[model samples]
Target: MNATHTPITAEAVTRVQAHYENVKKLGHWTSDRRFEVRARRGMAVLDLRSPQIPDGDIDVEVDLDHAMVKLLVPQDAHIDHWDLRYTGRGRVKDWTGENGEGRRIRVTGEIRHGEIRVHRGGVATLSAMFSREFVQDVRRARREGTEPTVADPARSS
Candidate 1:
């Protein structure tokens, strides 16, 4: 009798904190399936379109207070923020709240006087481009004599 074995990966969690400032994670960095974000009077941007991300569901726990959190996902990704607990003007801005055939991201935790914005596909790319990391990537690419990973030359001014 042959028994099929399902490989198991360590459930590593990435944490991001922004207090009165902005914190962003972009580009081809290694990613875990779980995340924790804490923002107070600031903003946090997370890019989940990297190739290093593993398959299956993703989990994000957020704690916001008068802050904003942005998620940049792939075109095919599905976002689920129904489990989030919000108060005051806190809200999750996902136009389509239905599940899709792509990867699922389950969001939980609480938001107080803040917002969570979700951007997919072209919008996500545009959002990523409007950041300091994009400029740094362009400069690094120039120094290395390689094309910038985040920006396209044909679309540049």
Candidate 2:
């Protein structure tokens, strides 16, 4: 990944477009500049947004500065049984039980400069998931002896 501080450029636009085309060829229906993906368990919606793209890939400079994911559960859904993990810079700021009702809660946060801060009531579920995925990706790169598209900070040492 490019550094968050970098500005968007035409080269970045080309890269993003290529990635989108590639993914589409593989049969995914992702075409929006911004998209919302619902979790398999119906517990949350992952909102993704980008500022530039010819097709689907996000411009490197157009970082996903904000991702507001909302978790929705049924009346019988068990909040206590749920676990949240947030991996990015934005933090959840407020979680309110609607009208003093117990079955619903709202989660909101802002991401800036690629850092995520989970608000006090925001669950940490997504962060943990992202961290695990990142580690796995690094491990796979090592096993394959392939340089990652993103620069490796450790190698700069």
Candidate 3:
């Protein structure tokens, strides 16, 4: 969205970060992963919840300036906002799992002039947040070219 003249890097497939200043998408399915985001002045959206990694611990590290990082976490994830320094506000809105052996999402990083918000929900709830058009866009991109997409976030695009 920043549209800055930054050559896009090969988007990470699994256990990688969804960086800024590039084209990226989190597919319909996700797995246990560690997503790192680094940006200077743009927004980063990291969706850690997906079909495969429905309920598990996720590692996230974000470094940004004048940018926002929004993470979509699963409802069962127990989030830990550790060692996270930021000039703006960062918060995690979630609840403990019923069985107490639920997922955990650990977020660590530093940010300035922007906020990092972690929102939690179930599979149905998270899926609803995205539109069918979003999935279609990925399919189209794959057909058109090797445009990086989150078709299967676990697999390198």
Candidate 4:
């Protein structure tokens, strides 16, 4: 009989711990399995659902071998008007490598007023670039710093 096994290293454990810590800090966890936050407009809402993540309702996995991360967003959620803005000052080498040859991207999907807007990264490249941008922003914020501001342009003069 032949058997195969995968060993988990200290680094892996640390990564998992860090990921959970970040998720908690991001307000992704709530008292209820799912929580809803009202948007500026009475017509829109932002819902933060949990347990669904552990139940496979949403699959967010990271592959270190491939140096890739994947996130699956549900369709029924009423996420109206989602904008992911990235602004940071960091050495590319700090995140990607010492040579600084990695590309960053950000992609966001929002459904508002019965309309869906999918902002894809790598708009210029054939491949998906949004992932890189999104990952870089998150990692940078966790390591360096982050300034998050919530504003409703529709209500602004």
* TM-scores for candidates 1 onward, in order: 0.84, 0.24, 0.56, 0.17
Off by over 4 Å in 2: 1-32, 39-130, 148-157
How far is 81's C-alpha from truth in model 4 (Å)? 13
| Preferred candidate (lDDT higher): 1 or 2 | 1
List the global CA lDDT of all models.
Answer: 0.80, 0.27, 0.55, 0.22
- lDDT tens digits, residue span 69-146, model 1: 998877677777879998888888865554566777878999999999988778888888888889999899899997
Q: Highest lDDT among the candidates is held by which one?
A: 1
| Candidate 4: segments with Cα more than 4 A from true spot | 1-28, 31-33, 42-53, 58-157
The runs of at least 3 residues in candidate 3 whose Cα sits more than 4 Å from the true structure, single-residue gaps closed, are: 1-24, 29-32, 54-56, 88-101, 122-157
Q: Per-residue lDDT of 1-157 in model 2, one digit per residue for the tens?
A: 4232233233411112221111111111223322222221112222121111123222111122333333222222112212233445534333442232222222222233222222111132333224444466567669999643112222212
**For this target, which candidate reaches the highest TM-score against the unseen true structure?**
1
User: Could you tell me which 10 consecutive residues in candidate 4 have the lowest summed lDDT?
Assistant: 148-157
lDDT of 3 by residue, 85-157 (tens): 8676544433332322345666678877666665555442353336454567667877988543343333442
Sorted on lDDT, highest at the top, how do the candidates line up? 1, 3, 2, 4
Please list the residue runs of candidate 1 whose C-alpha ends up more than 4 Å from where it truly belongs after superposition: 1-10, 96-99, 151-157
RMSD of 3: 10.7
Decoy 4 TM-score against native: 0.17
Count backbone clashes in candidate 3: 2
Q: Against the true structure, candidate 1 has what lDDT?
A: 0.80
Candidate that beats the other on lDDT, 3 or 4, i.e. the better one: 3
- What C-alpha lDDT does candidate 4 achieve relative to the native structure? 0.22
